[model samples]
Target: MRIRPVGRHALLLDCDNPGQVEAWRAELWRRRDDGELTAAEIVPAAATVLLDGVPDPATTAARIAGWTPGPTATTAAVRHVEVPVAYDGEDLPAVARHWGVDVPEVVRRLADTTFRVAFCGFAPGFAYLTGLPERWAVPRLPSPRPRVPAGSVALAGPYAGIYPTASPGGWLLVGRTGLTLFDVHADPPATLTPGTRVRLATA
Candidate 1:
């Protein structure tokens, strides 16, 4: 891991990959909870973790140097959220054709697999989930829709995500969920967060 100063308030931990990033993030959380570290926010991104609002960047950097990642995969102790989806999307048939499977099989595969929220981006409460079988990876739509309705369950590349609010997107829609992923007035706002496990189920 490489530590780099980000301005005066934050330090970025550059990890080898997302898995390492998660491992380091978890370690940081443990340190934060144990009063070994002080920060206003600790965020894990694609390949780095940001320690924001740090009081002493140099001390924190030294502490990180002595820290070792606990595990490569985010621990299963993370909370699991079930999302009910209606497997009826414009791209349902297309996805099935791509996988050489029937629509029901696609739904079954999605429901049976457990996923983890690797990160969040593109929109508020929009989480990029990992653990989809590599063979299930699919390409994004050639032309992004002007507007994709909220609650749309979509897949692009190797990730699955839900549209928290109505907006433009390119991920191919495979289903729809009724859950409120993001609520501005709600405490903590986003329902899906990094390291949170997810299970999809048919409505």
Candidate 2:
């Protein structure tokens, strides 16, 4: 793990892997809730967590530097969300070929796996989920679609994602859902915030 100062009041912890980031983020959030750490935001990414709006960067950095990398004892308050999906995407056959399985097997595998939100990027409410085994990793499309419809359940590399809005994307579309992933008028705009667990159910 490497700690780097982002600015006057923020520290970016570069973790070795996504597991480290997830574990550390849980620990940090636990500390903050227990009145141990002070920060305005604990944002997680692919392999890093950004501790933003910190009161004392120097002290926090030093303190974090001494910490060992391992699973934290923190009990995360995880949220589980079920997404109803129609496994009828244009790239469904391609994904099955890549996995060396039939179309139903692909759907069954996705339905069985409980994915977690690793991060949110690309567009508003677009979450990058991780949970699929590394061996089942899929490749991005050779060319991006001119416009990917909203709620398109897609996969790329080891991450599963849902397109929040109509836009150009490169991820392999395996399914689609009617659930609204993002809503500006809602309390929390994005439904799949980082750390939230998601399950894809056949619609």
Candidate 3:
């Protein structure tokens, strides 16, 4: 675990990969559970985990290095969530052109795969999922749109995601999902957390 300073209040854990992120997330949480370490918050991300508390860098680093997990270790339990989406977006045709196929083929290829929530960012509960069809490597829009409406499903640069809430974003928009991802009333907020598998299909 490589800890780096982010201004003064936050520290970043450079895990470097999704598997590493899961391992560190599991390890840190285990350590916290065993009282081997303490922190205010531990949020895992794509290839990195974050510790947001003004802890002494040296002491925190030492503690992290010393703690070890038991022989039988496992990544946190992940849930498989099926999210339904409608293939209707402003950028659908562009995505189709990029795929060098008809619009229906774009939808077919996307729906055929099950992706994992690599991390959540950009906006609240907006998951940056990975494992897109390798053939479909996309680039972001030349210029981002002013305001992508809430629930606008977008795809860009090997990532797929829903807008979660109406917010300015850069991921290409490909489809819209009827499912609601973030709600203050919901427990822990985002329905799909990192490490969780997501299966998307037509609504």
Candidate 4:
């Protein structure tokens, strides 16, 4: 782990991997709840946690430097969510071709694998989920679409994501879910929060 000052009031904690980032973010939230680290916002990214509105950056950095990384003290709040997919996307055959496998095999691989939200970006409620094995990782399309419809489940490199709202995208679409990923009227808005455990199933 490494702590670097982002600016005058934010400290970025860099972790070794996504697992460490998840574990550390969980632990940080615990500490914040317990009144140990009094930061206004604890934002986590792919492999970094940003502690903003910190009282003292140097003190916080020193404190984090002395801490040891391990299992989180609590896991009661981590949520497991299942997203049902139609498996009828236009790019399914292209993805299978990229993998040198049949269409059914691609669906099977997605259904059997479990994923976690490593971070959220590109759009509101859009989650960058990790868990696809390295062997199954693929690159994004050479050209991004001017507009991708909402609920389009896509894959790019090591991450799989769903389009919360239509915009532009380059990820290879393998399937789509009927469920609404984001809602302004909902209490939390987004179904997939950071650290959320997810599973894809064929509907």
Model 3 poorest 10 in a row by lDDT: 68-77
Top lDDT hit: 2
Error of 3 at 194 (Å): 1.9
Model 4 segments more than 4 A misplaced: 73-77
Structural similarity to truth (TM-score) of each candidate: 0.94, 0.93, 0.81, 0.93
Give me the runs in candidate 1 sitting further than 4 Å from their true place. 72-76
Better of 1 and 4 by TM-score: 1
Clashing pairs in 1: none
Please give, for residues 1-203, the per-residue lDDT of candidate 2 as tens digits. 89999989999999999999988887888878888789999999998999999999999989878766456443354788999999999999999999999999999999999998988989999999999999999999889999999999999999999999999999999999999999999979999998888999999
Per-residue alpha-carbon lDDT of candidate 1 for residues 1-203, written as tens digits (9 for 90 to 100): 99999999899999898788878888898889889899999988888899999988999899889988776444456788999999898998888999999989988998898998888888889999998878889999999999999999999988999999999999989899999999999977999998888998889
Q: Give lDDT: candidate 4, residue 114.
A: 84
TM-score of candidate 2 on Cα atoms, chains taken together = 0.93
Clash number for every model?
Answer: 0, 0, 3, 0
Error of 2 at 142 (Å): 1.4
C-alpha lDDT score of every prediction, in listed order = 0.89, 0.91, 0.78, 0.88
Alpha-carbon error at 196 in model 1, in Å?
Answer: 0.8
Stronger candidate by TM-score (3 vs 4): 4
Off by over 4 Å in 3: 5-10, 33-36, 54-57, 66-76, 133-135
